[model samples]
Target: MTPAFPDPHPTTSTIAEVAICEVGPRDGLQVEDQIIATEDKITFIERLANAGLDTVEATSFVSPKWVPQLADSAEVFAGVRHLKRVHLPVLVPNERGLDRALAAGVESIAVFVSATESFARNNLNTGWQEALAAAERVTSVAQTSGLHVRGYVSMCFGDPWEGRVPIDDVLSVARRLFAAGCSEVSLGDTIGVASAGHVRELLGRFTAEERTRLALHAHDTYGQALANVLAGLDSGIRIFDSAAGGLGGCPFAGSATGNLATEDLVWMLEGMGIRTGVELPSLVEASSWMADLLGRASPSSVVRALSA
Candidate 1:
């Protein structure tokens, strides 16, 4: 499927390629009521790779007590680790999670910290300061071991409990993460409340050098994820995080909805003549397969429209 709009900004030719990180197997399935079998999860990752996604978030190496759906992270990693040229990144919340991920032979890992104190406490059971400290520690260790680390700053725009997050607070966490040796820091609109203006304003705060090491992870709760992505694109961001079939929501965040769907993002990008290295038809097929596994229609409009 193609986008409905014409090239509104034809002269804006700064970015050549956009890298998408697919987070369906981890963030998407974490909140699912049914636990996906480890073998099936491996198949999903392979299918995503087959659809031209070079980077896929395989699973989270957190406690089973917290996310029972991804309890077989080790098996999932082992199963998909042999896929040539596909970078599989797993989420590591703490030192223990990092240890588990490292043992599973993961080449890349991501650590998360909330920009607001309320979400920090609610999600990680720690203050924002403590969360940063933990992220710093994990990032340091992971980088020293020759592993690539991606840092996430959640609630960068607005938090459910804490209304508007300050720009300074978000930058502080991002700077600390980069200082701690994270190759890139992904800014997350966790509750999907950010508008294009908010996105441009926030990206405006970062220097051009800092923008190179940044990525956008926008949720679509308010139907603003794609708009926010365009804002980021105008601001020089080349990387974005998305879930297949729009299959993610925060289990801890009550108001959180699905992450931006990869299929929809690719459609918009392709329509803009932007190169995403993803095949839209194959991606929609993968989303449909996942929707069947979850026993529900995909939340992605592109998937529904193309399938129809």
Candidate 2:
């Protein structure tokens, strides 16, 4: 039998509450071979909202030349009406991306910078210092425009070019992002090479208060996403980024899958009696719909088993 859905109002405490930022539409759809209808994208977001996810990374405002998948971002934004309580954040890689997102009336935006110099040079085509400078400029403009900006630190676990990222390097980048006015810095395992032990060792450098300002953005390429998440939770990190149906991959990193599936994360959290406030069955249903629309299989085992 399928596991019972989590209670709507459970009076529980020991289990920590985590903010699951669903990146299904933006990260998930961008890597697909087929283009989902604009109305379908809106339907996906609506279903996510109905599943009790308060913060959803709705879309990216990149140029159509780069990612034609999210070229319909403006139209999708106009169509998907979110609850006042829900936060619909979009990815804005630079000033131009921010401009488009602003025009679309996006309330929040995410800016990213790589931790290692090689990754920065290869992925962003800019040096580490230049990328930081660029992010500073974008963050300033976003703040002035009354948009809440979040920063992402890619290759926090390990760089494909350079191996074993130092703890000081990760902390320095995160501190810089925090100082640059980004509210939260999401540490990304861009290649999905992190182990639970590695997570504990790396996160040990930050204190409880410092950890609160961090978010975990992990890939499931090596199938260690859940274990890393549990380690992050132990370290006091409460926010995580996940894609629905596991529909994402780093165009820059070969063999890297998308961030962990939101469905799988919800299933694990609910099973552990952790309160995410996300309705798993409804959320999984949305993932199933999106997977069917894309004509591809889902990357989430929980979605497959539950839907079966």
Candidate 3:
């Protein structure tokens, strides 16, 4: 059974509510050298749902040649399709990925494009325009198939090759994604180079209405992910993406690090009296279990502190 979580947008709340999308099963594990078994991935996702994460990125449907770790996307989706109340969104890079996700009965899918030309070529082997066009095609097909589509604009802060990305470039990709029928666009700090000021500036470009359609995906390479997240929250962003046990980095991006830890985010949010509906202890337990399975201590401070 899917664990119950509060409404993502509460109709009445004194404190602002935030929605966390757990990307452990997909983004968190994609770059890991040790491939976790398919059944273990399914179990980890189930644990996340039970801990009250409303959205869980289950797996990606990319080619095995590209991401051999997630080659079992279909099997993972099949195993967890029975879970209710939680949105299981899988990443689909192109039409072929979308087809695989659809055949596996995926209800929601995420498409990715980079903000910088160099990273775009490195990750997708194409320029920004070509990647955007592909995203448009995939988004259209996914929407027509009755799947909720989320778009990811990577390197929104700074690219490894391109030092600082222009805000206009980031907005351009986001605009196209939104125009192409994506319900939400996640701005990703793929290299974890963004500071609080950078986050505020990027969000400042969006109108209040447009801001509602945005999500923040931060990495903790410089230990600034939480601070950047606070900046995003101050700018009225209520949705953020995080990984369990701080377990992911972009394989293609050198110097990249794990994503902002879900447990750490929850710890901070709950302390501020912001309701995320996640049981912190349960989340720590989940991450701790995952860390043990992966043969390491969790990278999240909250998980380590609590376990100690």
Cα lDDT over the full model 3: 0.91
Expressed as tens digits, the lDDT of each residue in 134-236 for candidate 2 is 9999999999989999999999888888988987899898889999999988999989999999889888887777788899998998999999999998888
Estimate candidate 3's RMSD in Å.
4.1
How much is 232 displaced in model 1, in angstroms?
Answer: 0.5
lDDT of 1 by residue, 1-308 (tens): 44243232423344678999899999999999998888899999998999899999999999999899999999999999889789999999999999998898888999999999999899899998999999999988998888999999999999999899999999888999989998999999999999999999999999999998899999999999999999999998999999999999898898999999998898888777788898777788888888998899999988888787
Which pairs clash in the backbone of model 2? Answer: 248-258
- lDDT by residue for model 3 (119-230), tens: 9899998998999999999999888889999999999999989899999999999999999999999999999999999899999999999998899999999999999988
Estimate the TM-score for candidate 1. 0.95
Tell me which of candidates 1 and 2 scores higher on TM-score.
1
Candidate 2 or 1, higher lDDT:
1
Q: What is the lDDT of residue 207 in candidate 3?
A: 94
| C-alpha positional error of residue 174 in candidate 2 after TM-score superposition, expressed in Å | 1.0
Which residue runs of candidate 2 sit more than 4 Å off their true CA positions? 1-13
User: In model 3, which runs have C-alpha deviations exceeding 4 angstroms?
Assistant: 1-14
TM-score of each: 0.95, 0.93, 0.95
Of 2 and 3, the candidate ahead on lDDT is 3
Q: Tell me each candidate's RMSD, in Å, in order.
A: 2.8, 2.5, 4.1
